[model samples]
Target: MNDILIQNTTAFFEKSFGSVPQKVVLSPGRINIIGEHIDYNDGYVLPAAIDKIICFAFEKNDSKKSKIIAIDLNEEFEIDLTQEVKLSKVVWTNYIRGVIKQLQDNGFSFEGFNCVFSSNIPVGSGLSSSAALECGMIYGIKELFNLDIQKLDISLLGQKAEHWVGINCGIMDQFSSVHGLENKVIKLDCNTLEYEYHNADFKDYSLILMDSNVKHSLFTSEYNTRRIECEEGLAIIKAEFPEIKSFRDCSEEQVLNLKNKMSEKVFSRVHFVVKEINRVVKACEALDQGNIEVLGQLLFETHYGLSQEYEVSCEELDMLVNTAKDDDAIIGSRLMGGGFGGCTINLIKKGHENDIKSKFSNLYLDTFGIELKFYDVKISNGTTLL
Candidate 1:
């Protein structure tokens, strides 16, 4: 366990329950070093669970009330066992509520429990903090209640909770939260939900996350719009290519043939989706061969397409990506998450960590006048009760 996580876990149980809990649960935040906006396309994504995670302390309560406290957010919520309340505001509490609702929907018997959640995962960094929190809660409840839930089942349950809470996210976040392994990236097929676990062992290399600090307000709205455009594009392609199951099934030639049917804007969106699908395939090949150069180049290409074609990247994202473009020590850099803001994932030489951080920090400060936070992340295990 990480030091901060250990400290937080120890303190959470001591403060909340006045004693050490029977168990602790950990669910990690994920970094999609590549494959942004491709999860919904039914394409492959390379995501790893970082050491940063949400740690929870819990114990079953005698009463039929589930009590949850968010130490970091300074919020507490309670729900009666007999009824579920849907709140108008979407706060940290809804995440817990969603989990309860999902379990109830599945006909699982659950009683009230006291859970205290604390995490070092930076919220709104596109690191899947929400998923981490949800998964942690699920793990804690499962352990405290002695519920026999499989990891995959728990992951799907968490996804349902997110959907219930108004964010129509794909299964990637939840999948990674549950299935993540140390020093590995999950290559998930969003359509079939079939996934293969692979190692991203860039020897003498590390992944650096550069937080742009430019909060993405349009993530919710634009995310839905992008999905709609992809569906529309799918319809256009399906008219000719009836065999096409998803954007992943269509080739560049097929998209070009139906290019006339879509607007330039839609076409651009389709273009990024098509190329991103191909990139994921190639990235897997690169991962197997351990070619950091090829992987880095693909990351740059993805950011470019996301910026110019998909139009999701903002100036800060663009500047951060371009700043790392020419550096030899850096192989790949791309904006992660729903775009507009968040961090760019960079594959850097392990020895050049300070150099890259110093260089990027100065570059970002001079250009955008905003300081960037660099998270030196390591691939870590996913959700588990301790």
Candidate 2:
């Protein structure tokens, strides 16, 4: 816990609401160590909560109305808990509103509350601050109301909240934020929701995010399109291969054997999903065997697939990964998240963090004339009361 930040948020809550908050929660942003776009394709992802976080302060009010404030945004929302929770015109509030609605829709009743939140997670750097916000609110509410909600259910409710807010996000983000453990990454089965934690001991290597700081307009629209494309390719394959349930059950060979029938685009999508799925499996094993080099190589392979086969990587993202590939100090690097311009997750020699950051930042500006940002993050525990 950062005492100063938490103390500030709590003080602001007291000044705004005229009383001390009953609960304060720390919800963390998450990073996928290896897996990326394969989450929606029934693939396993290795994600962990990071030190970056959203701190929420919650207090029950005597009345049936709720008041919420976004300390950083300088925004406040007021709503009657007994009435329908309509989608707010304010976009950020919708994430919180959706969480309240999820709880209310599921028959969990609680008193109206006042909340004040502030986040340290960079919004568009692909660290999943939205998930942190949603999960943090839900976890805080659970604590405040003393609700019978397990961590798994907290994650599910967070996912539903996101869907309610109109993002068709997979479970990886919420699960990682809700269930994260210190110095560990989760091997999450998106299909069954079963997961296992592996030690994330980078040893001499450090994990860094090189933010390209560019999000092409193609990101949101193409994200939905990719899901549809995966479904289209899978429906065709599953029709011929009766036993296949998802890409998890299917193989690279099967996807190849039917390549002639599939459209070139669909085939590429499926092939990437299949190969990426297997890559995650090997990645877990590599970590288990303490073969950081093998895991690093797998990161490079995943980037190639995301760029060439998945078609999600933009030029800036590709450059980030490609540059890391050539650097001897860097073991593995790949574009993280849905791509089309976000940060590339890089594993690099510990002593070289400064030099690499300087080299990459300068190179990026010279090549694209856009300022680059980088984050040094560490694995941390999931959402919990402060």
lDDT of 1 by residue, 1-386 (tens): 46677677668768777877777888899988677888878888878888898888887778998777778778787889798557548477788888888988898887888878788898888899989988888888888888899988888999999988889888889889889999888988888888898877978778889999888688889988998988888888888888988888888988888888999988999989999989988898988998878998999999999999999999999988887888888888999988889889888888999988988889889988999999988898999876
Which residue pairs show backbone clashes in model 2?
Answer: none
Q: Which ten residues in a row have the lowest lDDT in candidate 1?
A: 84-93
Residue 204 displacement in candidate 2 (angstroms): 1.1
Per-residue lDDT of 256 in model 2: 90
Model 2 lDDT on a 0 to 1 scale = 0.92
> Which lDDT tens digits does candidate 2 get at residues 1-386?
46777888999999998899999999999999887887788999999999999999999887898899999989898989999988988999899889999999999989888999988898888899999999999999899889999999999999999999888999999999999999999999999999999999888899999989898888888988999999999998999999999998997888999999899999999999998889989999998888998999999999999999989999999998889989999999999888888899999998999999999999999999999998899999999998
TM-score result, candidate 1: 0.97
On the 0 to 100 scale, the lDDT of residue 279 in model 2 is 91
What number of clashing residue pairs does each candidate have, in the order they appear?
A: 1, 0
